[model samples]
Target: MKNVMISLAVMGAFGLSMPAMATGLVAIPAAGFTGTAYTLCNTTGNFGSSTPTQPTTGANNTCATFPANEATSPVSGYTLIASTNRNAVIGGITVGAVSDRVWRNTAQTSCIFGARFTASNIDWDTATTGTQYFEVNDIARGGFGSASVNAGYYIQATNASPVYRIGRTFTSVQHRAYKYDTAANKLLLGTNYLDLPTANSVNTALTGEVTGIGPTVVASTTSATQDAIVNSNWIDFTIDVAYVDDDGGSNIVSAMTYVEAACDSSAVSGWVKTGAIRLRQTGQENTTLQEISIDGYAPPGSTVP
Candidate 1:
């Protein structure tokens, strides 16, 4: 009967562990998670006033986010491309801290600039509402038994819609250097690099800010359990993409966007259950997450300087 996000009081109640530090990394395979995974979200904009792309579940998962004006996005026109054709059976919940890649294309339409972005979800997927809800885990009161697989980081989306708000739960994430798929609409998630972009990681919100002292980690024993933390401070993760223009035409496009979130665990919109002591489905554990990193990007090349 508590907030699904695992309250700080609950953590304090469970903090009576064998040997652990207040701000140290949690052991891996903790919180019902055997490995690590990054949740991804896409938005449209520049650092100043960019907006997250509308989460339209089952509507051909969007890969790009174009800002409103040139001041908002680098894409000439405020156009976000949606690819058709069920290319390689995409869309599903992937688990663990696995290596993933991001690629985008115009789907053979031959657009001016092929652009798109993807990010790691904070706790669950709040892109859809009403039965289509997807979440990592929700802990019950008294540390009964709970199970969760949220990697503690999400590139959340923000808006008035219930879905967007729910998507920004727990921990937030930041991304960089979205690559271009070799195939027209194939959003690749692996190797094959060209020229990468420089990325910097700032703990604007990082995951611990809203969730726990560390990443989202939980362990439930007989009477005590370590789990997600709950705070209400607005969390922010930003990425600034820079493109230098050697051509006199001024084709340089460098901009960034910020994805803000909160440490709320209301469980209202749509929160699923992971691993917890409440359900008697979890056991003692620990997990340490790696820092987020930017993938890679290639700027448009020109002969003129």
Candidate 2:
């Protein structure tokens, strides 16, 4: 995935011409996706992070300018607000070419994030006793701790409790953004700007098999399927309120907390600027977690000296 990102960057650095790209729509899956008819536009291209300009739809959805590559990058009109890379061996799993990034649009109203785990041979077999978890966070400073509790907004998935969830930090609350409306059989959140029923399409671990959201896990390279190495390898996300019903309920139009903080007078915690990823590989100690940070860029709507 690093190679894919670098290649795209190189093409931009050169005078090479790329094809035209546009955004597409994404559906937020409700419990059984029973009565949820909401959808958000896919701001990033088909390559997700690699080609920011081309957001394709349906089959053969790669940007016309570049070949289909399972990588992530900021979409057109959006800036790379945060990015980080991880290359090492964790828990005997060779972690290579892994990147986590967050992108904010020009209006500062929305942000997109993506992570690619191109590392080979990451035996994520269901038969194993290991557990895997992934989460995207916006915090004041780099690294993870109590600060990430409700910095801005986040989406998390795992093989344990709170299987899948999303939240925003407008008020002081423990996991405020994640609330399951059992009676309605829908997900409730402080700021419903997060596209519900969100799924990690590129990564199998974050798919319905683990998070109970989005599409079924792609078939693994192995006959039995369930290998994260050969099947689910990358993940991407979008956080925006540009649609008709940003909150998924009330059908009332609204703005996202991150957008309000960056553009309006909305009061909340410190700016939801820093974006991070936390992962707990299967078989890792229950108390252990790995966090990656992308704190290099200044928050949108800020003055850079």
Model 2 CA lDDT for position 180: 28
Give the candidate number with the greatest TM-score: 2
- What TM-score goes with each of the models? 0.19, 0.29
lDDT of 1 by residue, 1-305 (tens): 02322432344446421221111112111221111111122323211112223333333123223334322322322222221111111134321121111112223211121112222222222353322111112111111112221111121233211111111112233111122212221122112211111112322222221211111222112101111223211111122211211010111111122111111222111211121001000100111122222121111121100
Q: Quick one: best lDDT, which candidate?
A: 2
Model 2, TM vs. native: 0.29
Q: Please list the Cα RMSD from the true structure of every candidate, rounded to 1 decimal place.
A: 23.3, 18.2
Model 1 lDDT, full chain set: 0.20
lDDT of 2 by residue, 121-238 (tens): 2432335465332222111122211111111111121110101112211100111122222312122322222323322222222221122221121111211221111111112122
